[model samples]
Target: MMSVCGYRWYPEYTVEEQYRDFNQRQYICTVRVFPDYPGAEKPIHWSYGLGVTVDMAVQDAAYSMLTIMRARHALLQNSELCYVPASQSGEEGYISGVYFDSSMEDPLLQSTVEMLENRDRDARALRMELYATRARLWTALTQLAPVVQTGYGEMEMLNPVRTHLPAHVDWPAIGGVTPLRGPLLPPVRGPRPHPCPYGSQGS
Candidate 1:
């Protein structure tokens, strides 16, 4: 059986210039759970972030996760978010671990911490929290362990705050390197050429 959830985060996606035409969009990214016969609506969608302040991005991330609950994990509706959003530059990160062992009385439990420290598939950081077990949430949260893919990266247990990005020695046009205002409409491709502002053809 497969399960999935939707999450969102405003990564510190730096730009050479924060352009004038930069319009805020309502993002409705979708995800899926295999072996689950959910239709299109199964994926999450929300507009609360359209033109919303940066402060609301974390709430939007939670909403995105809830849209998944409305489809898959109905029990999580009562569960508070383990983490909220934090900001550094253009990157908005999530606040996890505060409630990590919140559900464990002997908070120093080894197995639980090991789970938190371990890496999920693709080596993405994993946010492990021992959510309080309830009749409603018992079966659900456990099953959710393997399936939740997070956009707000996990706290690296060793050095959680180490800042780095995709190692780029000299990759052209990487990490918002493009001139921000270059084009509003996407480029058209064909045998014939389109003219640029200098009266020269082709980009």
Candidate 2:
């Protein structure tokens, strides 16, 4: 019922700094999803908006995360149903609606301008035509349901645009804010020191 989407900002390689597209500064935003969860079959990762500020990038990522959460919540609410991985499916299909209705003839019965001025036979005919048109439209909408799409189509709607990172990007060094040449790795964490039984190390 929760989304695993996480966000990060790279201000050094911003669109404004690299491309000089605009005067205002922007950020290179990245989102990583489904990496650590055991429930997920595979990870979904993507990024967006080199032109957007850091705050805006976070907002966009949050919106996508919420959408995933909603889908998960719906599945949890209905335990009888199972969720399909739209990205992994290969089927292509669409739904069709009803083709014919006698009500289509009503358009042929429209009244002329002369009938409107005279308040004559054509006026009564126009009223009948209008009524039939409304009825037909209502019937079609109420009777027909949208077709269920294939997994690919569902995946298209669900997933965000995939990220394509540029080559030869620089990364910041540990404890330093400045960018250095080459690809960056995740920060390494040192092991926690054992607590002393007596007191300070000096003692």
Candidate 3:
């Protein structure tokens, strides 16, 4: 039996808007040729794009994508020859994709993979580490004690408390602090004017 797969493929795309480390792009310039395999093959057509920032690479999420593409290859090849749109835009973490077929042989496919890899590397590098993440986790488990739980329970290191309120008040965790009162300004005195009602001329 012929199997089918639906995935987003970005053919020719342009960046309509861009922001820090991300770009919102649009692409719809390819026509898919689905002459054969229409009836026997379950024709499914859909596309999606993804972005993964560098620091968020916990549990080797990067590998998951490679695996997905690798798996989707067979299904992609069986579908009608089609063009899909794929795009990615976001701060720091961003991944983009284009409509693609089942093989990694396409030049565009190779380039797209390279681009994704580069973005991943940039993100990983910007955050400055892989092991540092592990180390941080290690520290959380082995070192710091929770401020609240003085008992022997495990703890994680947390950032110091930040305050925007008056220094005189106690800063408790989670609860909001009362804002300090400021001096009120006196109301401006304006001249009182007599209003002429009804007639324009005063008799």
Please give the CA lDDT of all the candidate structures.
0.29, 0.33, 0.33
For residues 1-203, what per-residue lDDT tens digits would candidate 3 score against the true structure?
11233333321111111111101111111112121433533223222222222112212232334333443465544444222223343355433333344355577666665665566555445434643553464455434434325755432223222224564653333222323433333322564122222123322
Clashing pairs in 1: 12-90, 12-91, 83-95
Q: By the lDDT metric, which is better: model 1 or model 2? A: 2
Best of the candidates, lDDT: 3
Model 2: per-residue lDDT, tens digit, 1-203? 23212322221121122211112223444444554435654435433333223444444344333333334344443432112111111123111111123243245433332232244233334534654664564455333323212332342332224243444442211131534434333332564222222233331
TM-score of each: 0.22, 0.25, 0.24
Task: Give model 1 RMSD, 1 decimal.
Answer: 20.0
Sort by lDDT, best first.
Answer: 3, 2, 1
Per-candidate Cα RMSD to the true structure, in Å, reads: 20.0, 27.0, 22.1
Q: Give the runs in model 2 whose Cα sits over 4 Å from its true position.
A: 1-18, 35-42, 45-51, 76-203
Q: What is the Cα-based lDDT of residue 114 in candidate 1? A: 46
- How does model 2 score by TM-score? 0.25
Task: Tell me how many residue pairs clash in candidate 2.
Answer: 0
Candidate 1 residue runs with Cα over 4 Å from true position: 1-18, 21-104, 110-183, 186-203
Q: Given candidate 1, what's the lDDT at residue 29?
A: 20
Residue 80's lDDT within candidate 3 is: 42
